[model samples]
Target: MSERPHMSSTSWRRSQPITSGFGAGWVLVIFGVLAFLLPPGGTAQQPPDPVPPVGVAPAAVEAENDQELQTIFRSEISFVRVDAIVTDEDGNALVDLTADDFEIFEDDIPQKIESFKLVKHTGVFDPDLPPPGTIRNEFDLEREAAREDSRIFVFFLDEYHVRDYNAMRMMQPLVDFVETQLAPTDLVGIMYPLTPLFDVTLTRNHEQIVHALRQFKGRKYEYDVLNGYEAAYAHYPTTDVEKIRNDVSLSALKALAMKLGGLREGRKSIIVLSEGYTDYVPPQLRDESAGGGGRRGAMRYNPLAGNSRMEESTRLFQDMGMRANLVYTADIANRNNTSFYMVDPRGLAVWEYDMSQVPIDHETDQSMLRILQDTLYVLADESDGRAIVNRNDIGPGLAQIVADQSSYYLLGYTSSEAPTDGEFHEIKVEVNRPDVRIRARKGYYALTEDNATRLMAPPKPEPPSAVSRALAKLAEPTRSRLVRTWVGASRGDNGKTRLTFVWEPIASGQSRRDESASQVMLMAMSDNAAYFRGEVPSRPGGTLPLAEFEADPGELELNVAIEDEYGDVLDRAVDELVVPDFTGTDVALSTPTVLRAQNTMEMRRIAADPDALPTAGRYFRRTDQLLLRGEAYAPGASPVDVTARLLNREGASMMPLPVELSAGGAYELSVQLSPFPRGDYLVEVSAASGDGVATTLVAFRIQG
Candidate 1:
């Protein structure tokens, strides 16, 4: 396998807002997904052997609830969507093309045409929306405003195959593609090959998104200077090249596919930016050693290279309104910036394109900007996106991809393929036209149990309602209300402090329940305000259930923040917890308040509700006949018996003091800071409750 070839859900966000009309689209879906139970000539049913993707199936993946699963099945048909720019041999959007101009294929088999319609982000009520800044939220309704509601575009830039120099060269075309191709409503994210490592930033704002793209260099890791073997240092090798570089990349790819599958809209486009990868010896674990998950035949540099991922990655992309667009490189230039050569196998550059013919755009080429673009056509072609050579001509290729408004046709067909094992098949989309080349999803994974399709079975697709259309333009997640989260602090087995987060769906402020949109989330901040290193998912459906995760107590210190399903942050709570896991220290503190009332000889006494006391008025009379004193105390500490000696500016006692404790040991002390007249009185007391507890007591006067 040429190291260069290839490229590559829903659980985190709710399918749609529930209150919106159930609508007829979902009710009238013609191409209901047909499950291929037994392959064409296969046998009877065998009990599904539970699979723990990482082994320990039971512990790894929670058991599925049949009833709950069924409920999710009946929900709306929320397919993932992908926003694509399909073009012809010429670089022009084929927008005028109709459904018939396209053919649909999956896993190398011809599929029956199902529901097909041209989607665009038009017809809206509210126009003004927030700009894309940073990934402040998970769902950006502004970005979702496009009305197409497509799946995400995950750009997997394979770093293992490309050298740092060539890698730098690819950014030019990518920058142009983002600047011109992506609409204001599109949400683009960049990722490298690794697990739990994603610079996943989402926003509807074009500027913010573009800024993020420019910052994407590549994955940089630091390996231990020592060899990593032996039990002594095996379990937690921070930089075990094999573990960090191999399966992790696969995990990122899987996540990309899942992100597309999770969309509740049309189609998805996942633009990969790397060569591709293959497993090393002993075939790294899949599920179980028995047959385990899928494995590469060898540690092939680029298994599937340009053509491999298109089949499945493209299919998954389409299922979720996603279409794959790969742009990997094939060659590299030396540091001298003088010549070119084949990338060394160990150099880490995977995908390559044909740069034999690259056009130059005036926009780029500033300064002696040393740019070297590698041609990565195989990847781009398979993804149904255009490829380019490094040079000045990237504009034309990118323009073609975004401008491809070709006629799209939706087809559906049933297959006799078995869903038991993960098998690969080939698909071809041919039309009876001369000089016409049809590009569609190569193939999809025949049903795999415990996976997405087999799990919740996407919600039914609903035609965009008037409000849905309006809100789609304004912001996403109009249906998702605020999320109610409870965070607790505790200690882990390692003796380190930990903060646990438990989240549940809350009412979206709208009063109604035909069906409500569940809140899905990707938590960025912990209860203590610390940032998270990995991504956290917030799936909306009630049946999918709430999830709990433990983070280092340090994360909680970031000033707790939460975002709704549409990526809008609705709340920012303070860290009020006193637990060790929350504050990082074992010291807990509190305050209690006390007050006094009085009547004066020369003034009239008044009675009113203490709760209604004017925060700034002195309506009641103070008795100078008696002195008043007050003080504050702390929790688990001695009660401070401090007395306040009342007086005028002349330092004379006015009256005795009365005190009261406020709620939760927190205090607000008040005394008469007014005037008396001809004379004054004095009162005092000094005592401690115990245990070095601090107290607050002061003397003041009322002037005549």
Candidate 2:
């Protein structure tokens, strides 16, 4: 085993930072449900439409004839995929162009287009088939999203820049776009400025997406603190706070763009509904006091603004910061092949700020409005998207988004440079025909050396050792957990092994089960001989039972049946356990048990009481804390030092945790789930003595 990472003074385990193709300050958790982990030697399955059949037809009819085909490039470090949408001068899609009519260039050098296909999506599906919204699990969602005819659209509702009135007014237009323009097979999801990209999922359920939009309310200019991020800087002046909001929203947009890019190398659209952003807030509107006192103050003018020169200097300084942020965001969008359709919800606005509160001159207001509109234009133009500003009616622009996705071309080329320097490479696509317009991604970020190797490596073979295979099996149970259980095997009377099983009903919110687990019927068998059988609990969310059974030392096969109170079986599982004789081993460690506490009071009681048994459940919430207890023994009563470390779902080590000695030859460790994201993890405990070392692993999951 490798040396353990230094333990922190805090009880909780420290998080391990993950770097990827995305730019700096982006933390990608290793155990995310959607982590892009491909098998060794196996390439990822691209979307079906990217390799449509070679034929020319009207854009409307080509989508239906898209055949499932793929052009496999030679094993290389990277497969560059670009999505391009060509149109005539009148903004009509040009779908009749062939591969010969287009050219691709990388860093001013023309590159061979290894594969070309005119991809089109009508979002049509069989009426009898269920929509993607019916995806109950992650597998179903991925399957539905990979379909050739499915269109992915994410609504990045930037409430930070949108006012309350504008948010309500724009809600109808967005709803109309989803209900009228989007096909049944289209996958649409809504995200906010603060929404975690890991939690964002594009689904085909249009009704649910629309329902969520109906409740949308913008928080612009509202200083009343809501989340922890806001509370941290609530005391800052309104102007400074607004700058922070812009930083957060822009950072999130860049992160969202990279996330969509990782899903598939197809065209993706993010509808940005906002009133645009500005670096300068008029001095009169900058509230130094909390709760926005300047908005309602009798004296609206800033007393600190003694001269016009000072005001101009401050605005200039702020505008520079805003420009830098906008450039960073545009780079991410271009690299990720995602387009941002900026829809100014304010429509044809005359002023950027309200006169009643801002008290700024009309001339200054007009200039600020123009600056804000230009910011929106730059974002759309750089990402090959359109900015719908200075228009009261945004319905047409919103509809144009659907038309753009209805027909497009997907081009795949292998980069001749293959640079592992981790720098951005520029790409340019052009059409040979005259009087035609072209729009495609500007470029992409090159993969690092480590990332390139991982992508090109083939799938690894399964480990031959039994322990390695058994540890791998632990992650499988997480896929379907009607009842979360914890099993512990220790010494028993008469040379028999003592097996303890504790179980509780997993909350329905955690799983998609309609039937509630009321009782667990357990049957224990050693080879062909029956040992113990009984029902552990009689009700859900009630006190659990620590059911123990004695069995002869050997392999024990246990069958568990999860049933409702009426005896209807909801789920079943067969677990094989090897009961070891502790007395014969020179050094041994008992199976570590976990005890969960909902609050500080419960945690204290669990720690103080030696008789307190570990919870036989594995799933826990973020608000909960945990206490792990186990015992180690060695020959001649030699002392044993125990250590514990956290592991990700793939069995990769994350960080080490502090293990303290408890009374009666036992070891205890405390864990706080608040620092970790919701996912599957393992706690590996090892006991070292003079003669040898003993180890055990326990798997658990944290819920939000």
Candidate 3:
């Protein structure tokens, strides 16, 4: 593996002032001197704009500048935007307050308000206005999410912390909230603790959200392993499992806040429905291990026995960590102008545990109950949202969640201190009018200098031309209606290129066709003559059907007909491809093939066998290992230098992959998917020779 070269000095110098130790006042002074040096009557040159503050859009920056810049001297300045909700004693929003009525302060120092706007959204669609469109993709999500009349809400259902009975009781309220509280124009999404943020879709389809909530069942205190992720840790101690559940839930909440932050700068709300979070399980219900077996019989319920000095210390440390996580999550939410509305499903609950499961002392039960409810209060209060706890009727509380998001005052200010300490800074928003209650986020975490610099840095270099072209194939529209296909071209005999065509039936549920595709009729032809035409039967044991043919290095046409078991055509597709001239004198690379192996044994077998068939499917599991094999060619007998590297979807190189030259003169790279998270990635293979250089990219996706 080789290290990427350092950024140029010019690039570093360009971003120096942003993270410089000098304050904004000094920056203004330097810019003034430069303006004086300019010719008379000339426009004062502006410095390159600093990276806009997180969650603040470029349009917002331009608007702020138009109102804030009254002098001839202007420097690159960043503004921290805050969303404040002011309501009178009767809970009516104060929408008519002007900029003069509000005073903002950061770290106890008064700051000038740079931008102010009253954001009032009813979340209702006007009858005269066109209806909102359904959110089918990222583009639609962004466009709909940015509308001022629309509000974004995501329900974070913490199934691990709520009881099954309570979850059932609350489902109707959640459904009703969607039906009556939310308008047709509002976009809503729901997420479980294990749900990926990418998988959570915000849409105008209210029925989909309700349908998902109806199936919400809690598994708190139940150790049955449901998924592969839980199976690995099902045998851990009961206390450890509780901690793990808390960690997962909190992490998910934090990620959801960040995700909402990316969608838009406006106030986003996440409704958390759970009993609450606790890092420690009571000794009365503590099992030696979660997996019930002989271990359960060995440990009897002894409430006082487990609370030793060491155990108490451990409990304290765990509680501290959990609290820190909650604070950090709140900070992120505040920075993103998002709020968390914590709803306790166990409304007016008396005991935290049931005696039927395990005997517990009254004192211990009450203490644990308070601790659980306190967690909810901390999360909600810190994020400037309401917490509905210990209440039998939560209808009004739930409605208030909507009311809070309905209207707010969006205020932006340039912190005179301009702290870059990467620490939480308190924000105080005061309205001059009396008899009104003010609610806003307590504070936000300032970006560190390094983070600011990185955000302001220039974008990375684009991928090579050949690699770009190869990646474009991944986006090619599939013409076949019943099956997916992969086509590759490599060096063939003489001056021709070897074309490999592989096909497999689309996943059973993904295809609209009733009949499964059993084979494909492949036809290869050039402008003047047909190259090859035959039927490729589908393999029975999960192997992909492949057809090989030789064609001249030029434009070629492919005709494919998908047939069922009875030989009746189910679908047809025609594609035009440009076969690369692999026999050229310049440095060249053949189409790369990706093969998957389930385990070490399978991986070794594939590595030893150079002729192993490649998988046509682009999707793979996180537990799988991938082998990328390709060939590099050069003019005459000159040896070609081949290298492999992993790249993100944006073409930024993540890391270099070591390439091995096999005995058959082929280049191979083994990538372990376990090290990579679930996302789309690319493998870049580059070959350089005395004559020239060439590169190609292979794109694949990993699934959890």
Candidate 4:
């Protein structure tokens, strides 16, 4: 692909927060995803495979649960939405179809049409929404995206396959299409094969998107050096490098289709600009040591005398790879209701190779061209889209894509057989009216047995009422939280509770100019009276001296004001707290504080120190260990032993971790970092004394 330009702005910082709305104790976890499955009528069932053993780590099981949850959620909606564009003999959209005029089926089983609606746009933007050119942030973009009438478009520029000359020629047509063919309310995004799906946001700023297209440059075969990823394999042979490039582009495209599918159950258009895909490189260009010049160097002397045996062997290998990639790509797009309109920019070309570089036979050149072009046709035809190939004027084809998006009939129905065997189910849509054609998705995937069971299972027991309320408060959304704050509680003097508040900035490459979270102003009060007020840290990016205050046992209200370097309040929040007196109880334990350490030596230092501060951030890397300590008290200085264990998000036990006594007689637990994978886990610690037990759960996420 062409190298991405360094466009400096807050665009990178405008990433949406990852939120998972599970129950109170469950947190959203991200990890490696499974491979994309092919759609129906394209591939046969492999056979009934045995259920995999459940002995894998919790991370794998959690991933399975997440996938199953998504599947079940889709199925439980009880409605399959199909977008159909009916065109008459003249190639104009026929959008006046009623619900009774459509028939839906799954695996040849007819289903009842529950709902139907006609979606039409007259090339006019909505009056209530903001203008197309006024987008400033991601929030503004999302507001426009939520509109039901808005159209979505993603321009996938496949520079890896396009020649530099072809890229330049195609830019004008694309820009013209955007400027003249699309409506102002349409939300468009620009993406490359290497662009992460999270970073691609739909926006109304058409001018900026067009400006980015003007700098398009293709890096087809001249891979010298551009980025770090490409540099790592620059010395590899050209044949191997070509195969890797194909896989990278296809994977990113599959992810993009899935992202669009999840946005809504409507039709989405992705315009792919490229030459085509080829598994086999011509023998004249294949070199074992590509940059070193082995066979290719000899080909310079006698280009027509290439080895047939070696060429045939390499061709077979490439065909297998290409077929597998094609299945996955088509399956993902069909299942997600996204169409891929492929544009081949090598227009009116006569030869695949330069005559001066490689003097190849005419038969070989024709064969190679046929195989490459076939890949493009298969992608477009299988996804219910048209392939604009073998033509010089792409204006008409580009305009047709927008027209298809403008008017369509949306038909929804409940599937008769709700299968949960994790297999592909075919879908067919037909119109009762005559002399008209129809286009729609071919199939959808069903959930697995395990996922369906969990989705139908009863809800887990709820947490204590007080703990439940506190956890619910964490679900509220915060706008660009530059800093994360935490409050700690322990025993204090004079039969009162000790409160310690800490705040730290979040480091995610999303900082603004001249803005830093200096300190926070803290205030504590009751319903009718105030307890204490103070300021922390006194400077930006500096740690505050741990201030401890005593408060009587009751419901205490906390009002916190977060300030910047100029002592200006950036955000303010109010919190409710319940304090308990430890002196009057027979056995008590403070809220366990977790302190993170990067290495074993740091862990030891933190465990031995009497005043190590707890980290406010909940995110931790796997390369870091953790030291958790808390004070357990008993009447008359009797002994109070504490034990700790790890639990999954479902509140089931995973393993028991060792708890030991630190230097100051504080109960400490050593959490090993290597055994855990990337997911949310809870550390349950319980204190045991004479006829008393107190337990607390500390939740945190480990970066994969």
Model 2: residues >4 Å from true position, as ranges?
A: 1-79, 126-133, 289-300, 303-307, 416-426, 444-486, 499-588, 593-694, 698-704
- RMSD in Å for model 1: 26.1
Local accuracy by lDDT, each model: 0.35, 0.72, 0.76, 0.69
Ranking by TM-score: 3, 4, 2, 1
Whose lDDT is greatest here? 3
lDDT tens digits, residue span 458-575, model 1? 4455532321222221121223334434333333445444444444444545333223323334343544554343323455333222333445534233233455446554543333
Give the CA lDDT, 0 to 100, for residue 396 in model 3.
91
What shift in Å separates residue 502 of candidate 2 from its native position after superposition?
6.2
Q: Tens digit of lDDT per residue, candidate 4, span 197-275?
A: 6567787678988998888888787776667787777768778888878988888788878666655556788898877
**TM-score for all models, in order of appearance:** 0.37, 0.69, 0.76, 0.73
Clashing pairs in 2: 40-458, 40-459, 41-458, 41-459
Off by over 4 Å in 4: 1-82, 96-116, 125-148, 222-240, 282-309, 352-366, 412-435, 441-486, 501-587, 634-639, 661-665, 688-692
> For residues 140-160, could you state the per-residue lDDT of candidate 3 as single tens digits?
776778787889899999999
Candidate ranking (lDDT, best to worst): 3, 2, 4, 1
Provide the global lDDT of candidate 2 against the true structure.
0.72
Separately for all candidates shown, the number of backbone clashes (residues 3 or more apart, or on different chains) is 139, 4, 0, 0
- Evaluate residue 142 in candidate 3 and report its C-alpha lDDT on the 0 to 100 scale: 64
